[model samples]
Target chain A: MGGYGEVHYTNPTGPGTPPVASLARFVVYLAHSFDDRLALRSELEVEDAKVEGGAAGGEVSLEQAYLDYRLAERLTLRTGLVLPPIGIINETHEPPSFNGVERPGFDHDVIPTTWRELGVGVVGTVPGKVGLAYRVYLVNGIRAEGFSGDQGIRGGRQEGQDASFANPSFTGRLEWAQPGWKVGASFWYGGTADTNSAVGRGAFAAPVTLLSADARYERGPLALRGVVANVSVSDAQAINAAYGQSVGSRIAGGYLEAAYKLLQTLSAFARHERYDTQADVPVGVTRDRSLARRITTLGVTYKPTWNTAFKGDYQLVRNAAGAGEHQVLSLGVGYQF
Target chain B: MQQPAHPAAPPAKVAASIARLFGPGARVDTVSVDTTDVLRVSRADSLLGFAAVGNVLGKDQPITFLVAIDPADRLMDVDILVYREPYGGEVAYEPWRRQFRGKTAADSVRVGKEIRSISGATISVHAVTLGVKRLLAVLTAWHRSGAIR
Candidate 1:
C-alpha cells in the first residue's frame, strides 16, 4: 500500500565512540493500473540488516512486482521477477538520474546494476540513420556471494559476482544512439557448480564469457565517457584459477569520466579507477596482479525539487599494487515517486 | 561509471513539437498518433516528446522529453516544457506516457504491437509508446485533412 524509510549513521573510525553503520529499511513502493494497458508494480522490502544476516533479516520479500505493456517507442513486453537489465543505475533509480554521490564505482564493485531475474524481455528503437537500442533478457543469474540489489544493481548492471550455475543464464545488450555518440555491448552465459575444492575445480564447467563497451559524447554543455571489460572462465579451477576471485576467473576492467555544470545549483565531479583484483584473478601473478585503487569524486548535488536529492562525495582509496591510501567521506539522500 | 554528459537543455527553442496533453491554454484540437513513425499533435497545447527504452533512463542513460501531458492522470494538469535526461520524476512515471489520455477517433490502436513492456520504464515506455503512436497518426491525418479545428 505504501513504502519509504531510511536512517543511517556510521561515525566509527576511532575515538571509541561507536556507531559503525546501523542501517534500517522499510520499502513497499507500488504503482497499479491494469487498464491503461496493464502497469502493475510492486517493491516490497523490509531489511533491518540484510547484508548482515540474509533472507531479508528484518523480513518481507517481493522486492519488485512487475507487469508493463506499452510496446512501442521501440518495443515492449516484460515478465515478472525481473531486474537484471544491467548498468546505468540498474534501471534508472532517479537521483537526478546519476552522477557520483552514488553509482559509478566500477558500476558498483564491478559490473552489478539493478540486477534481477525471472526473465522475459524486449527494449525498443530501430530504423537507423543512427539509432539502435536493445536490451535482451531471460534471467536469474548471480549469487556472487548472495547479492540483493536483485540482479540489476550490484554496481551498474550485472557482474561482480553471483549466478554461475543452476541454469537459466543468458543476457544480451546492444546500444547505439545518435547525435551524442553512444555505444554498448554485452554478452553472458551462466552455469557453474562442480568443484574438488580450491574454489571448486571446474565442477560444472562450460559457460563464462563477458565483454562490455560504452562510449559517449554530448555536445553543448560538454560530456564524454568510456568503459571496457572482459571475462573468461572455467579452467577446471586452475587452482581457483590460481587462487580466488570468483566466476571462472580471468578478468579485466576500465573507466574514464568527466562532468561540469558549475551552476544551476552546482555540479562538479571526477573519477579515476583501476581494478584488476588480479584482473579476473583466479591465481594471480601478471606482475602479481591485484589492483583496486581509486581517485574518485569530489561531487555535488542540491536539488530543491525534481524528485529531491542532496548528495556529496570524496573517496581516494587504494591497493592492487598501489598500497593502502584510504580516504573516505560521503553523504547522500534520495527520493522518488 | 563513465559520464561527461551535462546538458539537460540548450538547443531547440522550437523546431517541431505538438503532442499536447494541455496546460498553457486548454481545449484546443488537432490530434492523431500511432508511432513507429508519424507525429504531429498539430496543437492542443503542444508538449509531448519522448525516448528512453530500458532501465529507461537510469542505468546507463536514454532520456528525452519536451513535456506537457501524460503525467498519467494526476487529474491531468500537465505542462513540463523541457528536460533532456535524468529523472523528471522518472519521466513522470511514463506508462508509455500514459497512452495520452481519454482516447478517441473511434478508438482502436493499442501500442507497439498492441502493448506490453515497462520493466523499469524500458526507454521511458518506448518513448511514451512512440510518442502516443506518433501523435495518433498525426492527429488522425490532421482531422481528415481539415488542418486546424
Candidate 2:
C-alpha cells in the first residue's frame, strides 16, 4: 500500500493565498498466482483522503484486475483489465518506483497514466544478453465527448465501465533491456468517438494516435531515466465541434530524471518535466497556454527494506501563460507485502 | 500471497540440469525439498552441491527462480525458471542471471552495487539479491556444521 499527501501554494507572495493540503492517495496492490500458468492481480485505491459512499472528498476505485496464463517460455496470455505498456511510470508506478511525492506531471497530463482497459493480449521475452520483450492488445475505444481543453482527452478514458465497442483500439509495446540499460517504444491507435445514431452526439470518427519512447540507465549508485510521448488526433475539428470544447489536435510531453543512492537504503533525486496538452489547437480554436506547463522536483527517499519507502519532495511549477507560479511540498510512505 | 502449485522447475528438467553440471553420466538425487521449495541435491555418496527454488514478488506477481551452489559454497548459477509478471521479464534473461555466478556469502550481492539493477525490474532485482543473501546464509551455516561435504 502507498499513501501520499501534499501542500500546494497557489500564489507565493499574495495575501490570502494560504497553502492547501491534499490527501492525494492511499492504495493497495495485490497479486495471487494459482499456478505457474495462471495468476490474478489487482489494485484498490482511495483518493483525496476520505470517502462516504463516495459522497465525501475521497473516491474509491478498482485500479486493475487481470488474469495471466503462461503459454510458453517466452510468451504469456493475459485477459481482463490491464495497464497498457507506455511510459516508464504507467505500468510500474508503485510509490517506491519513483522519488517524487507525486508522479511526473508529463505522465499524468499527457500520457494520462493509471490508464487501463479491458483487453486481451500476449507478452513475451526473448532470452539473451540483449533482452527483448513485446506486448500487444486490443481494448475499447475512448469517448470523444469527454475530452476537454484543460484535461485534454484524459477524461475521455471510459475505464472499461460498460465501455462502448463501436470501435476498438490496438496498442503494442516493444522493449530492449540490458544489465545497465533499458529502452522501450509503444504505439496506440484508436477512435475516441463512440456516438450512437439515436443519441446523435456527433460523427464517430475522432481517431487518437499516440507514440512513445523511454529509456533508463543505471550504473553503481546513479540512475538516469527519460521519456518522450506525443499524441495526434485525426478529425479534431469534428471532435471539438461535437463536444463544444477546445481539445487540442496534438499533445506532447517528456521528462528527464536522475537519482543517486547515497546509502544502502537512502537516495536523493531530481526530475524536470515539460508538457503541453494544447500544443496544437483545433482550427480556429484559441489554445490554452495555461495547459502548457513545466515542473521541477527535488526529493529524497529512505527505504528500510526493498518493500517499503518514506519520501519527501519540493516542487516548483510554472505555466507558459504567465499565470501565478506555485511551489509545493509533499510527503509519502509506501509498502508492499 | 498464494504459492504457485507449479514446481520451480520441472523435476525431470532439474534432474537433467544437475546431471549436465556434474557430468552426463553422473547419477543425481533429490535428498529433500521442503515447503519453501528449497531442494537438497546430492551426487553419488557425497554432497556435490546445494540447489534451491523459491519465489519473489516482482512488480505485481511472483518470479520463480533457481539457485545452485557448488560444494565450495560458491554460487554456480542462478536461473529464472518462470516469470509471471506482465513486464520486467528482463530479470529472467540469462545474461542478467549470470551476474550471480561465483557469488558467495563473503560477497555482498547487493542489488545496486555488485548486482546490476534492471530498469523495469528494480523490485525483482532487489528481491533476487535479498533472496540470494538469505540462501547463502543458510548454506554457509549448514556447511560450517558439516551437514554437507
Candidate 3:
C-alpha cells in the first residue's frame, strides 16, 4: 500500500478573485500479486480533499484499476480502467515528477489528463540496444453531449463511468528511450456519438482523431521537454446542430520546458504553452478568440527527498482576445510513497 | 533491509553468461559471508573477478540483479535476473545497465548523475542505483579484507 497527495496556495491576479488555499489531491494506491504471472493495481483519488452530501465541489474517484498478466518477456496484457498512453503527464503525473505547482495548460485543455476509460491493452518492450516500448488499447467512446467550444472533447470523457461502448476508440503509444534522451508519439481515434440519434448512432459517427509527439532530454543538470498535439473532429457541424452547441472542428496546442538544477535539492524551470480549443469552428458558428490561450510559467522546485517536492511558480496567462489576461502566483507541497 | 540469499547454484543461463563474459575456462565458486553470498570467478589459479546477486524493491516488489566486479574493484557488468513489477522494467535494458560498467565504489552511482534516469521508471532507477552502490561497497570491503582472495 502507498499514496501521494498535494496541497496548494494560489493567488490569481484578477479583480475580485480571492486567494485560496486547498488540498488539491490525495490518492491511495493498492496492489495484489495473484501469482507470478498476474497482478492487480489500483489507485483511488480524492480531489479537493472532501466530499460531503451537500457539498458543492469535491470528488472521490478511481483513477486506475487494472489487472496485468505477463505472458512473455516482451508482452503483458492489461485489462480494466486504464489511462490512455498519450503525452508525458497522462500516465506519469506524480507531483514530484513534474516542475510547476500546477500542470501545464496544454495538458489540461488539449490532452484532458487524468483521462481514463474502460479498456484492454498490451504493453511491452522490444529487446535491443535501442530501448523501445509500446502500448495499445481499445476503449469505450466519449459522449458527444458533453462537447463544448471552449473545452473541445475534454468534457466528453466518460472516465469509465457507465461508459458507452457503442462508439469504441483505439489508442496507442510508441516510445524510444535511452539513458539521456526519450522520444515518443501516440494517437487516439474513435467515435463519440454514443446513442445520440440526432447526431446519428454508429461507431464511426462524429469521430475524434488525436495525434501527439513528445520528447525529453536530460544530461547532467539540464533537462528539456516538449510536446505537441492536434485533435480533429469529424461531423462536428451535425453534432453541433443536433445538440445546440458550438464545437470546434480542430483543437491544437503544445508546450516546451527547460530546467536546470542549481543545487542538489533545488531546481529552476520555465515553460511556455499555446493552445486553441476552438482552432477551427464548424459552419454557422462563431469562433471564440478567448479560447485561444498562451501561458508562460516560471517556477522553482525544492526536493529534500526524491519523493517530496516544494514548488512555487508564477504564471502569465494570455489570450488571443486580449481582454482577460491575468497573472497567477502559486505555491505547493507534494509527496509520493 | 536484509539481503536476500543467492540461490545455492547459479542458474545454467547465468553460468553460461559468466563463461561467455570471463571466457570458457572461467570457474566460479560460492563464497558465503556475514552479509551476503558472492561468486568468485577464476581461471586456473588466477583470479578473474567477483559477482554478487542483490535484490532491491522496485515500486512495490523486489528486483533481483547480479553485479560483477573486476580485480581492480570496477564494475564489469550488471544484469537483471528477475523483475516482478508490471512497470519500470526498463531498468533491465542493456543500454541502461551498461552505464554501470567501469564504475567503482567511489563513484556516486546516482540517478540523474552518474546514471541516466528513465522517463517513467524513476523509482526503479533510483532503487537499482542504490542497490548497485551498496553491492560495490560490500565487494570492495571483501577485496580489502582478503575475504575471498
Candidate 4:
C-alpha cells in the first residue's frame, strides 16, 4: 500500500472569499497480485481533509477499484469501478504528475475529471514499435435529471453507487505513443434517461456524446501538452422542460500548457484555458455567460525528489459575462509514495 | 498476443541487435557466472561490448530487456524485449531508452535525477532504472575482478 496527499494555501482576490489553507486531497492506493494473470487495483480518496456528521465540510470516496485480467501480452480485461479513458489528466492525475497546484479548469468544467463508473473494458497495446494503444468500456450512464447549466453533465455522474444502468454508455480511447511524442483521441457516447419517464426510458434517450483529442511532446528540457473536447446533449430541451432546468445542449473547451526545465529539479510552466459549459442552450432558454470561462496560469514547480513537488502559481480567472473576475495566488506541496 | 512471462529474445533477434550495435561479423560468447549469463561480443580480435539480459517487475509482471555496455563501461543501448503490462510500456520507447546512452556505472542512474521520468509510467521507469543500475554494477565488478576478461 502507498499513498499521496497535497496541501494548499490559496488567496483569492475576490470579495467575500478569505484566504485559506487546507489539505486538498489525501489518497491511498492499494494493489494485489492474485497470480501472474490477475491483479486488483484500488484507490480511496479524502477531499478537504475531514467529513463531519451532517455538515458539508469534506467527502470520502472510492476513486477506483478494478480487477485486471491479463489474457495476453497485448490484451487485458478490466472489470469493476473504473475510470473512463478520457483526456490526459483523468487517468494520471497524481499531484506530482501535473504542472499546476490545481488541475486545469478545462478538465474541471468540460471533462468532469475523476470520472469513473462501474464498467468492463479491454485495454491493450499493438505489438511493434509504433506504440499504439487502445481502451474501450461499457459503463453505467449519467442521469439527465442531474444535469445543470453550470456543471453540465458533471452532477449526473452516479459514481457507481447503486447506479442506474437503464441507459448505458460506451467510452473508448486510442493512443499512439513513441519517444518524445504522444497523441490520443477519446469518445464517450451513451443515454442519460435512466428510466425517468419524462426523459423516456430507452438506452439512447437524452443521450450525451463527448469527443476529445489530446497530445503531448517532450524532448530534452522542454515539454508541451494540450487537450480539446466537445460535449453534446441530444435531448436537452426535453429534459430541461421536464425538470425545470437550463442544462446546455452543447459544451466545449480546451487548454494548452508548456513547461521548460530550468534545473534538474525545477521547472516553470504557463497554461491558457477556455471553456463554456453553457455554450449552447435549448431553443427557449437563455444561456448563462458566467458558465463560459477563460483562465491563464503561470507557475513553477520544484521537485526535490521524484515523488514530491513544491508548487506555486498565479491565475487570472474571467468569464464571458465580464463580471465576477478574480485572480488567485496559490502555493502547494504534494507527494506520492 | 501470447507472451512469455520470463522471455529471452530469440537467438537471431539477439544476434541482429549485437550486429547492429557492434557491427557485422561480431561474434558472441556467453560467460556464465553463478546463475547469470553475460554475453561477450567481439569483432575479429577486438572486444566490442557486453550485453546482459534481465527482467524487472513492472507494476505486476516482469519486463524483459537487454542492456548493452561498451568495453569502456558506458551504456551503449537499452532494448525492451518483452513488456507484459498493459500500461507503462512507454518506458520502452526509444527516447526513454536513449537517456541511458553513455551513462557509466559511476553515474547515479536514478530516475528523476540523472535519468528523466515519464508521466504515468513512473513504476516501470523506476523498475527499469534499478535493473539497469544493478546490471551495471555487476558488470563493473566482473571487469575489476577480471572474471570475464
Q: Whose TM-score is greatest here?
A: 3
DockQ of each: 0.05, 0.58, 0.48, 0.25
Clashing pairs in 3: none
List candidate 4 segments past 4 Å from native: B1-49, B53-64, B70-76, B81-86, B98-119
For model 2 the local lDDT of residue A202 reads: 40
Greater TM-score among 1 and 2 belongs to 2
What's the lDDT of the predicted structure labeled candidate 1? 0.46
How many clashing pairs per prediction, in order? 84, 0, 0, 0
Off by over 4 Å in 3: B1-13
List model 3 lDDT by residue over B90-125, tens digit each.
Answer: 888888999999999888777888799987888899
What shift in Å separates residue A25 of candidate 2 from its native position after superposition?
A: 2.1
In angstroms, the error of model 1 at A84 is 9.1
In model 1, what lDDT does residue B15 have?
A: 28
Q: Which window of 10 residues has the lowest lDDT sum in candidate 1 chain A? A: A147-156
Question: Order of all candidates by lDDT, from best down to worst?
Answer: 3, 4, 2, 1
- Residue B126 C-alpha lDDT in model 4: 87
Alpha-carbon interface RMSD of model 3?
A: 4.4
Clashes of 2: 0
Complex DockQ, candidate 1 = 0.05
lDDT per residue as tens, model 1, B7-118: 2332332123332333233332323233222222223455332211111233223233443223121112122223222212223433434444454434554422334332
